[model samples]
Every structure is written in structure tokens, then in C-alpha cells.
Target: MCSNYDSVTSPERLRIYFGVDAPAGSIKGEVWPLYQAPFIRRHPHADVGDDAVPPREAMAGLFGMLPHWAGEVAFGRRTYNARSETVAEKPSYRDAWRNGQHCVIPVEHIYEPDWRSGVAVPTRIQRKDGKPMGIAGLWASNRKATGEEVLSFTMLTINADDHGLFKNFHRPEDEKRMVVILRDDQYDEWLDAPADRSMAFMQQYPAQLLMATPEPQRGRRRTGASPTSK
Candidate 1:
């Protein structure tokens, strides 16, 4: 599951890369669940209808799927990562998927686990060439009883048992999985294509273009706190 990731992409680069006209305020550093991060989606045209909308624009949304009928924001915690295989069938994701509520979550890097030492170790994964990656995602609009609309999203993941790089991560007993990263050529197609055809894009990213580095766990005290420090 892609629970955390680096979201330091500047607004200027987001405009240039996604070709979005809407201004994207800076969302620097790591983004965790419930944080408002930039996402690119084709907004619905208010004057016209669902079919008519301006080009895909950048917007900030919470990093979890809070369905409209949900009573509280806490539901998001479990809806942050939607499995691609059952996305269309799952209760929390089926509505968004069938409605073509697709989105691209641009990020600098993603964090996963490496369990080689019997304990899960955090590792940062990034493109070998150093370009930003557009991860496939699903977006939703939740209307609250208090007359508020909450925009949220969830990353789509797939089984990666055969993936060379991704398979090296996660627990030994757990099934390996990875988020679906879209290529430059496939971005527009993924956002515009119908549900049936869009399934073709749900594949693992090539491991050749990726790299990983084990990182010191965040919040770890470097000195004077832990018993091992002395």
C-alpha cells in the first residue's frame, strides 16, 4: 500500500508537466493520510454539464476516499489505498470508478517497506532518471450533513509479486503490491479513456527505471534519548 510519499513538486513544474491552467499552490515535503495534496483532474463545467469541462486542472484534495454518504472523516483512514483488481466492485470505490472519477497524483517519490532484516524497514523509491511520476488514482466528492463538500482521493494499487524492485519490499509473509504509475504517453489516455479501456493501463511500472534507498525512519532521535545512543 502506498500510504506515504514525497509531494515536493513545485507549482510551476506541475503546470508545465500536466498542462493545467489552474494555479496549484505549493505542497512541499512528505504528504501523509488526511493531508491536502495537489491532484490533477478534469473538473466538471458548472454552466454546461458532466460531459463538458475545461481541460484537466490542478486541485488540492485529502489523500483518502471519503464517500459522500460517510458520516465522519475517519472513514478515510481505511479508504486511502484502493486495490485495482476490485476497485470497480468495492463499495467505497465502485461509484468513483464507474463515474470515471480518475485522477493523477503527481509526486517526487514514494516510500515502501524492505523486510530483509525480519523487521519492516522504510525505503524511499524514485525514478532513476529523476523525473516526477504521475500515479494513477481515484477521486471522490463527499457532501456532509452540515452542507459541506469534501474532496478526497485514493491511490490505486496492484499485485506486484513478480516485480523485481517492488517485490523486494513489504513483509515476507504479505503479498507484494505497488501503485500504478502512469507514463507520459499514457496520462491523457488514462484520464480520458472509458472504464473498460482504462483497465489496460493498470500494470506495474518497469523496475529498470526505478531505484530505492533505505532511509532512517522519521522521528528517530539521533542522540541523548534512546538507550542505544550511549
Candidate 2:
């Protein structure tokens, strides 16, 4: 399951690609569970006979989904990635799934561990075309005891045991999984698809269209002074 990724940080790119003029608020480039990031969803008035309104809109949301019953924001940490197979059955996700609260996460890249060498190495995965990926996800809203409204989302993942590219990551004994990357043309369809038809969009992205490279962990520094220094 994906717990971290790079969010699309360019407003121009968000406008040109996702049709979102700008993010709802400032967001960090590196995203982890519970981090604020942008997600695209069908406009609330899209079906309300407003021809002048855009069909889609971008909004800032926590990277992990929070069901209404969740007591605190911490609940998001464990709900960051929802299994597509069980999304409709899991209590934390079934409400959003049943209500068709579909959304698309604009991701620059996703980091996963590469264990081919008997050690875990961080790997960055992105589209071979170098364009942002529109990942399928579910969005939900909750109100805290303090009456603060929070918007959140979770990436949808599917089995990747036979995928040529993703099968190489993670431990060999662990079940392989990868997020569902939607095509450019399917964004609107995904947002508007009914609950029964949602499963139709859960297909895996073509492995040939993706590329991966090793990326060292961030924020590491030398422990002591330089050799030539004091």
C-alpha cells in the first residue's frame, strides 16, 4: 500500500492538466499520511444546471481518509490506502464508496521500497511520459468535536502480483499491490461513475508506461565534521 508520494506542486500544471485553476490552499510537495494535498472532484453544482460552472474542482484534503465516525485526525494514518477489492465492504470506506465520493489525486511520483538486493532501498516511480498521474481515490468529510470540518481521501490500490513493473518492489513474500492510475480521459468519468460501475475503473495502469529509479532517503546528514576541518 502507498503511504507516501510527491504531490503536484505547479499551479499551471494543475490548471492545464486537471483543469483546476489553483489548489484550494498551500500544500507541501512531499505528501504522507494525514498531510494536506490537493484532490480533484466533481463540482458540487455540476449537476445542478449550472452550465457556466466547471465540471471539476480542486480542493485541499488530508492524504488519508477520515470517516465521519473517526474520533480524531490520527485515524487517517491507517486509512491512507484502501484496497479496491474490499473498499466497498470496509466500514471506514464503505460510506464513501456507496455514496460515490470518488476523487482523483494529482501525484508527481510515488516512493516504494526496492528489496532486490537483500536490503530496502527507496525507489521513486513515475510516468515514463513525465506527466502527473491522476490516481483514483475516495473522498470523505468529517467534523471534529471542535466543529472543524476536514476533508480527506485515500488512494485505491489493486493487486499487482503479475504486473511486470510493480511485482519487483516490496518483499518477495508479501502480496504485491499498486495504486490505480487513471487515464487522462477517464478523470471526469471516474468522478461521475456510479457505485456499481466504480469497479470498472480499477484496472492497473500499463507497466510499460511507467519508470522507476532509486532515490535515497531525504534529510540525511553526516554525523561529524568534515575530514579536513577541526
The candidate that achieves the highest lDDT relative to the unseen native structure: 2
- Model 1 TM-score, all chains together: 0.87
Q: Go through the candidates in order and give each one's C-alpha lDDT.
A: 0.78, 0.87
How accurate locally is residue 40 in candidate 2, as Cα lDDT from 0 to 100?
92
- Residue-level lDDT of model 1, residues 57-113, one tens digit each, is 777778778877877876776787888888888888888888888899888889886
**What's each prediction's TM-score?**
0.87, 0.93
Give the TM-score comparing model 2 with the true structure, all chains together.
0.93
lDDT digits (tens) for residues 86-132 of candidate 2: 88989889999999999999999998878999887878999999899
Which candidate number maximizes TM-score? 2
Query: Ten-residue segment with the worst summed lDDT in candidate 1?
Result: 221-230
Q: What is the lDDT of residue 219 in candidate 1?
A: 35
Q: Which pairs clash in the backbone of model 2?
A: none
